[model samples]
Target: MRQAYSYVRLSSKKQIQGYGQERQWEAIQMSALAHGWDLSDKTFSDLGVSGWKGANIETGALSQFLKCVEDGYVEKGSVLIVENVDRLSRAGVNRAVTLLMQLLDSGISIFTFTDNKLYEPNSPNPLMDLMGWALSAQRAFEESERKSQMILNAKAKAREEARTSGKIITRRCPSWMQVNANKTVFELLPERVDTVRKIFALYINGYGTPRIGRLLTEEGRKPLVGRAWYPRSLSRILQYRAVLGEYQPTLNGKAEGEPIKDYYPAIITEDQFNEAQAILHEGGAGQGRRGEDMRNYYAGLLRCSCGEGMHIVSSKVKGKRYYQMRCLQYRISCFGGSWNFNKFASFTLFALRRLPLLELMGSRDNGNIKQLNDKVIQLSSRLEDSRKQLENTINAIAELGLNELLQNKYKQLTSLIAETDSQLHAAKSALELSHGQVAIQKEDTQMLTGRLLELLANTKDVDSRIKLNQVLRRYLSKIELEADKTNELRYIRIYRKDGDLLVTAECSHRLNNALFYGSDGTTEAMELVRE
Candidate 1:
């Protein structure tokens, strides 16, 4: 018997997760071996890549082997085994034909393990059978596309209905707005609304983005959407011209290219929104680097030395100098090179600083790192205890019958689980709590660490500036760098309080001098300071 290679593939998601691929591979290999074929030197390969995808497979050893056959690599009498016809290709029309014929004309005998059919070049009905397989592949492709389009259309229709009816549509809402039982307009917090109202008032009073964000966060105000009170959200509320109630449909989350439709109850007027913008950009103090941007650097390229922010600070050749664009999140600036924007423009140059960032862009801690072994032991003991208690409770219930027993045995079981969890937490804490010890939960820690290292190693298309961000997230928080020259980013600080995992940007003047803005002219701006 001629030597042959076995090919295994999954054509559809249904089949991909099923036993079909494994079964097919087993059947073909077994049959070939049974027929007195010497298979010890041969390779059994699987093209795990989805067949419908048109990209050439370089990494797929099995798939590449098939291609090699088509390229006159193997003898015509050599066997090419596939589990099923669909496993060959779901790519439609000409592309599908080109691939199928490549395998066929290579003179390799085609064998389908499932149907037990063999196709030889000398077969009279070869053309008819190939056509049948090709037609089936085309149907699967058409069906997949049709399903995708239907889902998208449904989503669009649902959004439209939600906008018109004034009822919130998505289960996913921002942090502040509480979903009501009836699913009505979001329940805006009365206290937070006052903060929102005051933000507008501050903008009217000539305050810019920095002061506004600081004031709100200092007052413990949060955005209507997300949990944290982000500066970007403040900008959104300020830019919304309809806050004064002029009623433009664009004020809502309408897409730009999309035809604007009348939607939402407009609270502010367009004039109010525009006035806020004017306040943000006008006057000697209000001169933005080039329209009040939220970003402090060129697409997050710079960090404040003070760990606040380093915006293009401008100051007039004046007596009392003030800084702008410094973060107010921190008590003080770390970068410390605060200047007013008006005078700084001459030095900073015409800053187009256009955003390439158009609104772009998880761990369960079981055992304690310091105390993993202790935690595991403690948890095991606790679990054992819970089991005993549960057994006693169950037996008592049987003896006492329904009326005399505990009201909810299930609830008691839940408490037992909680108790076990607490014991585990304590044990883990104790083990890892020692100063000079490796992590107790080493397995989970290693997994997370490995993933982070993978992210750092990928240098393709991304450079050092991007690397800084990856580094900041991995080792530090509130990463601040200062610019001494045209593009020298120095004076780095990571805001990592000891044993605290939360990493937030510290918004001191020294820190924010070279940082960018996060407001959209709808909010107030703060003066940058040099500390």
Candidate 2:
């Protein structure tokens, strides 16, 4: 007996949960019985996959059926049954026709059960068959296109309402929040809020995403979405400005309009959020997995005067272990002199402990901050003007029909809007850093300095060393080392995040000591430079 296989598709979760699949299967069975074909229990299903976008063909079970047909696993005389031609595809007329022809050319008879239509392998009325397929494809495409536009329109209306009324528009919100019964307000999930706050606290305390994830998992804390905490998810949570009660409207996955501040209940303070952003900007957080031991305390911040990273190398000679810091390009250039890692680390720690924290935090250029704020405002106005011009051009084109001048103007406005939007984003990021610097200056520097001194004293373990390195990066930008022509004296420069010089020192490898140099051409021995 000839064999028949059923194909079913439902484009949404709601459709999948309804009687769509069962109805299709029932029709397929009835058709197979009527034709005396053996209906195979193994059926292909693409549930909750979009046919309009060809997702069903790309990653769904329909792809597997195509593979089977191409490999000759399904016999030439076998039957392929679907509820309607749309179940096979709604990807538009050209693609739909191509798919229909491919299946028919494979010698598989397609039976669409909706109209009891059998598209035979070699139809006598080929033109009629083609017309029928084309019409069905066109209908499906039009319906899907109309539905998509309706959805876009509805979302635009909701966004407008949200902007004017400050009401929650959609059920989709942060994991820690939910829309109220009338969808006019958002309510926080207390448990998830606690988790979010904990994540930010852990990140500010110098724990990387992977480490934070592991810590949460070990403590048996349940994630809002998944069974276990993931590093990427934790990192995203730490970066979300939503915790600060801000909502950035997006269109087609890109930020669209101005951000709405104070849109949700703030989970963390602006200070805490700014601090976290500062750490992220310095590339301190989200360092993937680490080894059992951190070999260098100055992992990313240390570099040679030749603009190359100072990589660490370790070796064991007989019973003694030695560590050396060398330029990454030393073998090729030989310009960056090597230093004993232990002595260099000690000297750096000593100088950092005595540095004034308040001065470092307040070193940012107020002029630069003001310039960025002005740039943000100017770009925002330009973007609004360009968008309005684009909208007006679109209206003109609709009224007067397409012309060379209008088309050019539309393209120009589109390009201008994109460029201005990009500039606006960059300016906002710089402004965020300025705000973070201000927050840092407002902090209790005396207490912070005391904490720093304590942390600097406790770097014996790998975890402590890693934590201290990340913490120092929040304030200090980079440390550069150079050597005199003799290669005996190593000169080190410590720079704050604002690019201001914090300290300059010279180290003598022979004496295993360093001397701090003041800007007034005075030198103080390391022992005399007190905290």
Candidate 3:
């Protein structure tokens, strides 16, 4: 008996009211049964995929079908079953005909259920090929053009309405704002209003886009929709006038097209938004290049008190190499100046040495640990299930021979299995790291202190120093330096990695003599303070 593979497809989302996948499959089933062809279980269905995209495109089910054919999965003399010729493709008259001819040339016979016709490899039928295939292509092209005209007409109506009644159509709402009951006007999402305010505050406080993204992520603050904050996404928020209740048609998230007032509720005041824009306009100093061998160890770590990043600038004088950390916006919007590389490095080391090493390796509660463990187990189970499904699908496809129609499911299963495996591996790694943390309680502090002091002294090599710095960064978020009122003393303010100020100290220029300001209603917590 000849092997038969069923191919079914829906052109676009507009076809929902038209013939459905079930109807197409039903027709193929009846036709295959009547022809005595052995139908396979796997049926290729490209739902919501545009036929105009064609087989050369990377996406859609048809692309995967062609890939299977190229990989020598579909054998010659196999019967290809479809509800209709248009179900195979609506790429164009010439392209569709050429593709069908190629399949026929390969010894495959195409049986169209709708027409109850058989297209053979050698037989030429101009009437069926030209009239049937060509008409489908022409109809597809006309439908596509009609849809484009409809969109243009809708956009024109929306534009006219916005001009007259101040109401514009939007596809999606902004994170900080929501639509009203009628979906005609925008309103503030109360919970997200504070988030939008905080973003502006961060920008005004001197944190650049990249730094703000990191700060939000570390603080466990998610965006209005997505998992993590993006710098460009933040930049758009910074520049968006919608926070001031203005309607702006954005092109690529930038203000370009048109503007209307009072389209959205004001989440942030106009003055505040204007000030934030001014601060953002004064762009951070771009990191050019330092030296060939010398690298800035604190490139991403160092921040200026003026809310700008300190980049490394290298200079060679009298054959001696020198590096200095200068604020990107120094002498302009930033009053905080530059520092010598040695002085910056030494100050950072001094601050790091004074850190509580035991507390830095803080342990999570039993509940948190259990949650991580459970996550790993859950992901591993899912990974295993996906792998089994993939294996079963592959075996079924191989048993009936390589059917191009079935390969779309194979590709999807393979991708799903891979994604699950990756997620599982990441979960396991996080579980192991959580378990590995050496939490030193108050009783064990003395022992840990001695070991830490010993390690600090012995860490002389560049590699050892780098590792020690990395560990310090986990506990110490930033080190902001500024001169005191008298300009006789420099202050080194230490912050936690979560952007919280932990300790502030007045120190000598070299950070040799240090006195920390305490918050326990006293001026001294010289020992160690931890959460």
Candidate 4:
């Protein structure tokens, strides 16, 4: 029995009229019954997810389905059932075509319930493939354009209304103010207003953001979103001009419409607000030291232990400034601590020097050559099969009357043959390119090693470190830091350009501490372990 996986998607929560998930589900069940496809227990449904957003496929149920396909959980002969082409994707033609090709190339048949049509790997209809994909993609583009215009019109009208009526229309008033349902009237929440005033007073009295945050936490004063207060949150409140009764209309956190002055009762005087801003610029709580520049050499190559990207942040200790790498998600919820930039960079150089550079480069070149050769062989075989199928189809057409079904089949076979021929040509070209790369690497093997070693050895200065980082990034894909359950750095995994793990070394912090604190405190006395 052929297994079928149904994928359903509703772009919006307001889709209750014709494009509801229930209607799509019923259609998929009926189509499965008629086609003798055994519907699997697993159904991928992306409710309230707009397929037009390119992010939809990278997240949610669609991502899960793609993972299953990649992991071989869905067999080659499996069927992917969807209500329509748009249910699979409404992204642009490039994304849609790429996804369709991925599914078809895996030998999976796509069954669209709306048209009761089946799209197979070996048989492709230009009309069905091109028209279906193009129509859905076009609809997505039109819908996005319409929504954008609507938002612009709405904002413009709101700004005009605010200008004439002395009222500010907003999604949410400040934490100290409350708006009526229509947002035409604003009233002060006495307790929250008092808290906002106190925050402004604290900043004016020389309290920095971190101190203010600590004071708020101690007082049990809740913030707009969460219970605890972060320094950045307090900094934003101090910087906001809304405390002076000014309303700034923003779309996506960017100032869009006009600003309305005296929109609400003032919590602090404009003079006091200006003074606080001056203090902030003069290296107040939120501001790092002035005239101090820090560069993050491993900006794009470092990953946190929790699989999050690490970002550079500056900190001050005893009048000295330092730059470190912290997880980007640390502000929200992640607990992974920061890594000293210089320490991490030195450790990276040490690890790379210990590696057999020439052997690794040779292996990388040989691996690429082998993979390209395999791809060329596979495409050549498929091309030969497609040619044979097209020849047989043409012979059949000559013998029989040109029936509509036979004619459609002939067209499909011809399309498949053309597609296969194109793929074969691409594979041959790629094979040649890989061979050329291998030849170039072979000729410059010594020179490349010498350049890399020179960069690694002279990375004592910031400028040299930057050059070394760039060279390392060209050879290495990423360095992922994994943490233990206790939140300690466990190990750092290094990957080459091909996504293969090159080494798993002890966490740099551990090595650093051991080397600096070992007996005799000498470099020759240090021991290294690889795991």
Best by TM-score: 2
TM-score of 1: 0.36
Candidate 3: segments with Cα more than 4 A from true spot: 12-19, 55-58, 208-222, 228-232, 246-261, 269-271, 284-531
Candidate 3 displacement at residue 162 in angstroms: 3.0
Could you give candidate 1's per-residue lDDT for residues 279-320 as a string of tens digits?
343221111332233222222323455434444443555687
Report the lDDT of model 4 for residue 48.
78
Clashing pairs in 3: 206-307
- What clash pairs does model 2 have? none
Looking at model 2, which ten-residue stretch has the lowest summed lDDT?
Answer: 439-448
Q: Which segments of model 2 are wrong by more than 4 Å?
A: 180-184, 201-232, 249-256, 285-364, 442-517, 523-531
Per-residue alpha-carbon lDDT of candidate 3 for residues 376-462, written as tens digits (9 for 90 to 100) = 788778877877887887888879876776688789878887787778667655554444332212212443355434654534554
Clashes of 3: 1
Question: Compared to the true structure, candidate 3 yields what TM-score?
Answer: 0.50
Better of 2 and 4 by lDDT: 2
How does candidate 2 score on lDDT? 0.81
lDDT winner: 2
TM-score of 2: 0.74
Worst 10 residues of 1 by lDDT: 352-361
